[model samples]
Target: MASATNTKIVSSPLLVLLLFSLYTSSAEETGTTLTSSTEEKNVFVLDNYGARGDGEHDDTQALAKAWNAACSSSRPASSLLVPKGNTYLLKPVTLSGPCKSSITFNVKGTLLAPPSRSDWTQDTIRHWIMFQGVSDLTVTGGGTVDGNGEIWWKNSCKTNEALPCTEAPTALTFHQCDNLKVDNLRILNSQQIHLSVEDCANVRVSRLSITAPGTSPNTDGIHVTRSTDVQVRDCAIKTGDDCLSIEDGTRNLHVTKVVCGPGHGISIGSLGDDDSRAEVSGVTIDSVQLYGTTNGARIKTWQGGSGYAKDIVFQNIVMDNVQNPIIIDQSYCDSAKPCEDQESSAVEISNIVFKNIRGTTASKDAIKLSCSQNAPCSDIALENIELKLEGGDGDPESTCQNAKWRKSGNVVPSPCKGSN
Candidate 1:
């Protein structure tokens, strides 16, 4: 409707029921289901930009000649302005739609993205803004898309500082798009992945404000790889590493009331060790809020991994100064030692659930289940989970576990007995 806020990717429940029935149906039924009959497509106008987007120069060919004259406007168009205080130094200009053809980008100006590479290519597609195979696309207002990335996060490690050394790429990607809608943009400083939903479908990302620096290593604040039926709601992520990472061919996802912090909190699979791809099923991360984080809710599966991380759910999350508030690492290794999996498709972290979570762990283990004694972790659930670690009486050579930690009528969380 007229209040669909800003977006990043995945949203199209028939374009939110045709913009809420065309904003309460009037004005001749919102001009018979809008698609721009000048209903609103106000393209760049900050005195035709001489300098203002504050990223300086290369005004991206004058905002890609005003977005190719407003998505080739020939009457029927509906929303594409960026007018606030004006700081529009754009480059990658693409807005494809013909299917249901519903576009909206009010975004009160400050839409910047010009770090070069010929201002982000088109046919070869390098990112900044791209949505091919679009359907009812949306990117709402209260603008800002500053991807000036301080020269790629100060050379994001030229020699491998934990993998994510992008020179300039991925700042808002919507690959293989459909029914997508990215909302309420603020999305700042990006060298790599600040919002990405690949191979999307019926997606929705709402009330967003995805940021960068925390040292800006991989950026990564909302990265759903090989996607399908996604939803990330009420967001406000602080980056520099995994603040919501669902990878390895993801499936029907949902992450709600998010407010992640300082990075690395809400993850599911580093998954890539030849991450077999396809089979990360029905997922959910609810009511999240983590500050000074470092793995508050994680499910990392890998050791030379394959597929199947099914039916996951992490409920009502809240952790402060976390260091591993609640974890499930299926022998995930990064080569300093444990790397030997000749053949083991073992990813099955099944029917997982963690409801009513409450936390405060500072340097490790409030709960850690390092599965895979030979692929052992199935039907896990922990309702009413509470965590409290960060003091001296907790790490007596820690290595917590719960082999069959099920709870609902009996409760059990103590049988991991392997310490360092």
Candidate 2:
């Protein structure tokens, strides 16, 4: 009996390693971690921090506690895990961080937002989930963030003009972060913009699936503002508004391998609103497909604004039944009526290149460039363009005004009979 007991205890190295892993997993499951003196605890589980994950119970406090512990850990790197197989209901929360080290928020489960506006406090009316002031962070783990925004959509002023127009909360926002990586997330039914990147730098966002109904109001897939050196790629976005909107103060932004449908196509503004100044430069949008979208590769600015949008390239794009395939509307007005014509201080748009663009336009005018009279667009280049009307009617036409453009290669609809 003594010999048999010793044999069982003295197993092979493989068995010993397996036993150790089992023990560690058991400790994690029970939330029994070793002391920091013995071993650094780097993984903070939401369930261990008292999140029931029942989809009904509020998990806000538990999430906050877990984040705090992970953010304050003395380890070189820490991870906060929202484990799989559970749906956590979270109220409005801002996960602010100036972490002790690099942090990773791994969402392997579902994060469900509150069902209605009544659950939002006055201070929390603008955002549902936010991460701010974090650097060297990575957010991934192939999970779902369900905004549950049906109630908010019903109350939208666009849906019901009788209701007072108010701001709906964005689903996920990252503000003032640097060296961030966000990927492999499915965001559904956002209240407003699905993901907003503001004042961030060196960010990479990819492999995201963001979806809302075509009629859902103001649900932009991704909105970037005041961010630098950001890359957005491999995203499939379908929403009521622009698939991607690059606002003012954005520089060196690159977007590729994107699929957009049932929404407004990628836009470089409705910038310079309220007579404010806007500046955007060095933006390249390539390898994009727009299906049944309202517009394609568009730039829209208000009439009475100052600043410049330049050095932009839209290349290798394909549009299917798009209403406005290629457009530059400097007189864009979203107000209830036509904007009061104030052309005194318009935003300067220049050096815009539309290259290798082939598409089928849903409208008779395939290309419309209506630039500001005071600040007309210059150095607009169109190369290798072939756009035809949907259903093979007569060839599409081009409309141009106050635009100085140059064309090369096979530019169909023949470019409005003007040259550089």
Candidate 3:
């Protein structure tokens, strides 16, 4: 009887099928599925890993665990999901990976940062959320990251001189990542810069709404440095600092269909500071709208720095109430101490074109090209440019120092010439 029972159990195909079905069902319930070939693809939910999503508790450890699981999975495609209708408060965390396969961080809920500056220690917490060395990644879904930066802003030396000055953490920073895509996200009230892309390649960012108070100090909307093949499109950014600041070692960058206001307008540099070398080339900015900005279409390099900025183009720009609508200031000094007069800046500026720019300037000098004397600007061109001053009569004025350029087609304010 025992032998017959064993034989029946061993030969039961229905039992084997039932066990297989249960395994598959279990896998599906755990946000993973098994294919016919028995390979698993994962969708790791944060809640499953002990994330409260209550907006009060720290979910940093929970998020880290989910990321590690998804990143270590053997799946060809995996996703770490922050599900909708919840807020997850996160402390400073670095999500680092060269994962086994392509991974997506699907954020469908709000992520909140610590409210007070005292909650962050400077050396250890320079960025609220950092994604490093990740490739083939997509961060999407209509969500928000709130930096809760009111206290930090109030403590800033720029806002209050009585407070001691300190560096604030960036809201999101991507370092050494490749083939990354970020879209449909809103980053708000950052302690400092809202988004920073550093040493990355093949990055595409679109449809981002980044905002901070106009009085918020050093709150740049997007800061890209030492990156390549980047495309930023269809973004609306209003912040205290530059809407887009492109730093050294960046190439083949394209910015289009952007709207900027209550911020310093898109800038190529404040490069070569403290005598460092800088290089930027192959940049194009088109179809942009700027309103109530400090500047529009600017390239600024410090006096004592060494580098080159070339092959840049700004076209089809419309500005309203912008100061320094078109500018290239070689002697840009923001320090309280006066910049010493020098013969020239070592940074070479060349091959820059501003075309089809129509704007109203808050300042009388709509276009100011103050290039270095020793290394004068060359091959600069202004075509179809028209600018008028806001709340003032007559055509706007342009000033050029040590800059040589060719002009064609409807330049409203005539450009000044350098004695070459």
Where model 1 places Cα greater than 4 Å from the true spot, the runs are: 1-69, 73-79, 85-106, 109-184, 187-196, 200-223, 227-242, 250-259, 262-264, 269-294, 300-320, 323-326, 329-367, 373-397, 400-420
- Per-residue lDDT of model 3, residues 360-417, tens digit only: 8998888898988799999999888878889767678788888888887778777763
Each prediction's whole-model lDDT (CA): 0.66, 0.87, 0.84
Q: Which lDDT tens digits does candidate 1 get at residues 5-74?
A: 1212223223433443343232111112223333354433433434345656556555555444555556
- Flag regions of model 3 displaced more than 4 Å: 1-41, 342-345, 417-420
Task: Give the higher-lDDT candidate: 1 or 3.
Answer: 3
TM-score for all predictions?
0.34, 0.90, 0.89
TM-score: the better of candidates 2 and 3: 2
Give the TM-score (vs. native) of candidate 2. Answer: 0.90
Q: Where does candidate 2 clash, by residue pair?
A: none
Rank the models by TM-score, top first.
2, 3, 1
Best by lDDT: 2
For model 2, the stretches where C-alpha displacement exceeds 4 angstroms are 1-41, 418-420
What's the true lDDT of residue 86 in model 1? 60
